[model samples]
Target chain A: MKRRTALKVAASAALTSVLTIGSAYGAEPIRFGAVAPKTGALAAGAAITHWPNIQLWVHQVNERGGLRMKDGSRRKVEIIEYDDRTNPGETIKAVERLATQDKVDFIVAPYSTGLNVAAAPVFAKLGYPQVAATAITDKIPELTQRYPSIFFALGSTTALASSVADVLAKMKAEGKIGNRIAMVNVADAFGIELAEASRPIFVKAGFEIVFNRSYPLGTQDLSPIVKGAKASNPDAFVAWSYPPDTFALTEQSKIEGLNVKAYYTAVATAFPAYGGKFGKSVEGHLGAGGVNTDTAEMKAYFAAHQKVTGKPADYWASAVTYASLQVLEQSIEAVGTDRKAVIEHISKSTFQTVMGPWKFVNQSIDKVWTVGQWQGGVFHGVASTGLPGAKPVIVKTGW
Target chain B: MTARETRTLILVVVAFALLACLPLLRHGYLLSLGVDIAMYTVLATSWALFSGPTHYISLATAAFYGIGAYVVAAGIGTLPYPALVALAGLAGAVAAALVGLATLRLSGVYFVIFTLGLAELVRQIVTWVQNNFTGSRGMYVLTSITERMIYWELLALAAAVFFIGWRVARSRLGFALRIIGNDETVAAHLGINSAACKLALFVISGAFAGMVGAIMAPRLSYIEPSIAFTSELSFQVVIMALLGGVHRLWGPLVGVIPFTILWEVIAARFPTQTVLLLGIAFLLIVYLIPNGVVGRIESALRAAQRRVSHA
Candidate 1:
């Protein structure tokens, strides 16, 4: 009877010690879910700009001992990711899974405007603060009204269009280019919105629309569009293109000798691969969303990003994406893993990130980095309209 | 009914009963997955309803599907969901009848090319309408319905398609279709009214696909021309049907479930190589089991029975 009592006492002590140690060592991980285009047409861009940044952010946060919770305990981030396949349907399904099935604490936004817009309702319904990193749209007022938890980190479409128009207007005034302008857009939400916004802005700036065309998304051959624009012999060319078509249009333009003093393409024109592919030919080419690479913070961020991810961040949305993650992290650290608290914190606070200080004004970024140009193999901010960094726009040289 | 028929009916009833209880699972991701699988099942089975028995290789699934999606998008606020689904079915049947009237006379590669061209034509027209008339880049449908409800709707649509397919497979229409598939010239010589039968089946098939698209549109919430008219939709349905063995009624169901799960798994695990892996797997399946998993399993079971009977 004594031996039996001692055995029971020893087992109880062992179990107690085990329970205490386990409780002390094992705090539940804060789960962050993301749905990005890991495959399909947008996969290449996502790899460079979206996924790598997320990976880097998660790594850095964990390395720094995770998020400092409001209750004074630290929890490591546990990332749950899904590939949206760059399809809106897939994106919606992924978001639904993240919110309902995985029950992630937070969800990073998908990459593009169309996807972000499509997913806004789902996020709003689930009460997630969707800080969209690459969504550029003109319908901010409507979207904000519908989805109060959604925020656009990228600049608005109107701001982008007006900035480009302003640069062209300045060029026209200086006699660097003629008033005739050629514009072509991909027939999708992102391209269509930009084109619609820019048309009136360009006309108001005294530029005659010499050639205007819209091609379907995922179009393989852009030779006809480039040839048509060249036949018109416009003094400026603007292509509101996605990544694949951006590269295709530039290639076809060079082959067709479609020379214009002011050449601009959207999306992937700021990609490092773009400069690498075009070499010196891409110098003086203009794109959307440029970074002031000379800033010490920007330089360090780029260096660390390359070192960590083993891939170069693009000149445009990569920094924006990383900054959005920073905002989420800051919000989470400030208020713990409670999503409602995170959303409230993000709405009220300003965060200093890779893109400098970011504060939301009515769910849209107050400052916009509108137009960028490739000069001497580097993308420079040629027109930062509502933002600080600005460089003089240079006339694009012939390929 | 024979014992085999009774057993089959009971099994189907029980299967549907279990599927109806899917909402009880209460996993949002699984519900969404069930909805997707149900959508693909409807599409694949409907495609096979005509194309399987006729061997016409219709590539116009996207056209009908896109039309149905657009109809729902256009009538979102004005019409109820059930009403929109019926209208979408009517629209699909009418469109299919028209397309069949024009292209049914053509056979072999010409029919395939015409159907392929039809999808592109419909897509361009929708794009034009969206750009010129609506001036709306995208259409959003506000729905108070839950995902569970959508899953049930899709499940019902899939069950309907399965029932229709099963009935047609046993009826005179299915016999006529098989004969026509085997040899159109011989079927016509036998006074089968091959053209009329083919066109009717085509219309029926399209109606089911359209209903599925209509049901799915509200779930998507936002519809753009590009999303609605993707050729990938047609290709995916065709692949699913072919992968499951188009000749059998349950082949599409078998194909859709596994492929959908595989897709979710591969897409999550290996996002970059999804297409490549899926392509390789498809090629292997085609090489090993040309008639699909159902066909292979059926063949294996028959051989086993024969061996047992001999023993």
Candidate 2:
């Protein structure tokens, strides 16, 4: 019996050794896993947000002799990314595979709000601390309240909406804007949440929301929505949209010759592609953003980002992604290894990152968030600038 | 037992033991790769039941999978795991039967297009359903996951599918289905009940596919239209069956393991080049091994014997 057991064990061990040869090929870098859309509709946004700062951070850290460990040793940061293809199911599968199979030290969740929401419980159950870079929703706070191991770098949805309202109020007080507005959003959770949150804010700010509509994502034609919003004769058009929808709405608005005095959008509006694509038409447009050259820290980050990424930082999503990496770095440094200790480290402490300072209120829930906007090709930080190092950049559109 | 029988028994026992011990043996990426193998094997075997025997290709296998997933997710109210899985399979069969009835009259590439069109239509439906049933966001079930449970579930499902494939290969239904595949008009003239065989195969294929999806829905703890129903995944099923020598019992299992492992290795190390390399490999395989990896090897060995006999 003993001999049989011993032989079986030996055979298993041999197979295991042969299988893990790939793991032994490289020096154990800080094994980090990222869930990004490598292909599909959102591939460009995914690349811009997930890859750039990661490469930048990896370069900077390698320059400083890589990640510092508790044992006074250093290892280079290595990222293994799976393209979720902007699919939530794929994202969850990738995260699980990363957690149970690759056993990476840290994992970066997807940039899509939907993808992140779908993946939250999986990460939480595995006791892996997932830092969400792009998923910002009102539901996150409640989700965080339940899970405690998940963290969001940005301000919560309510806080972000209130801050946008504050900015709009301030702009109005300064006589730069009026009370008439039209709100158009994608018929998706992220867009719907933003529109819902903003509705109350707009009401509180005493602005009449003349036209409000929720259109589907990936909808080819937006002429109807533009025409309707145009006919509403609003002072500003507030759009909660992704790149495709943003471009579609912008094109349709231009085609229809809709003369809305001001145009503002959510997500990816700060991308130079937007400005580059639309040019003079996009000059007076406003969009949400986080990373800008307003502060020394931000300026330094922008320079580093530009040098490494070979492009200007687009939006706050990229900064949030970088900040997530920073958290992963700190946690790994504190715990020495990734899996069990990393979560514990992240659960109980605060870390400084690209978004200034992020401190989780409860380790299980997503509590921290903020809102940003683009002003003259810059993502001006308008909300959640109360962190230790955050510098607010307030701006007015149609200048 | 005869030597051949004993050899088969030994191989079976060894495979079972390896599957049982997979979790204990490998962790992280390797373990996931193993799970992927099991998943693909199940998918291929199920797909082969329809395409191999009856010659009716389903481009909407993934749509049935999505339907199964969404139903289970939506119906998780008070059902047990087995019950839920059964329900999913039933739903899939019903869906396949309904679609098959409508399109079975169309033959050749038109049938293919109809199935493809149906799959796309289902995709749109799921996307629309996602808004109401699973929220505007992606659907997630907040629950605990055990890798061991998933691994074993997949193993059990694969074994069940292997048995079904074995029985089908030997049964009368299998011969009728095979005749239909070779020449439907001839089989129909000879009173083979062509439509019945095709519809039966279609439903059987859908059932197996649905069971796999039901297992997968809870394992990943999430589901979406695109993830549950991608053309790539559907193609992978056919690829595995083709590479392994379709219509054979062990073919899909054999094909999926090596290809899946190779894919993982390439994807992990050289992600940008993985797809390109796969394309090249596929081209090479088609040119060199027209009958697939297994068929080509057997043919080569047979050719060598023929040469020796001539000598």
Q: Best lDDT goes to which candidate? A: 1
* Per-residue lDDT of candidate 2, residues B20-100 (tens digit): 788886454455566678888888888877787666666777878877787776777567767888898898899889998
Q: How much is B229 displaced in model 2, in angstroms?
A: 2.0
Scored against the true structure, residue B310 in model 2 reaches a CA lDDT of 100
Q: How accurate locally, in lDDT, is each candidate?
A: 0.85, 0.72
Give the per-residue lDDT digits (tens) of candidate 1, residues A1-399: 999999999999999996675465367778888998877667777888899999988998889887887788888787888878778878988898778867888999888776887788778878899999888766788788878889988877788878889989999999999999999998766677778888889999999999999998789999999999999999999999988899999999999999999999998888999999999999889998898888888998899899999989899999999999999988987987778888888888999888888898888787867899999888988887577777888998789
lDDT of 1: 0.85
Model 2 ranges with Cα > 4 A deviation: A1-37, A67-129, A137-149, A155-183, A187-216, A232-236, A283-293, A331-342, A364-370, A384-399, B1-14, B77-81, B132-134, B304-311
Give residue B185's lDDT in candidate 2 (0 to 100). Answer: 85
Q: Write the per-residue lDDT of candidate 1 for residues B150-246, one digit (tens) a residue.
A: 7888888878888888888889998998999999989989999999999999999888877877887766666766677778788888878888988
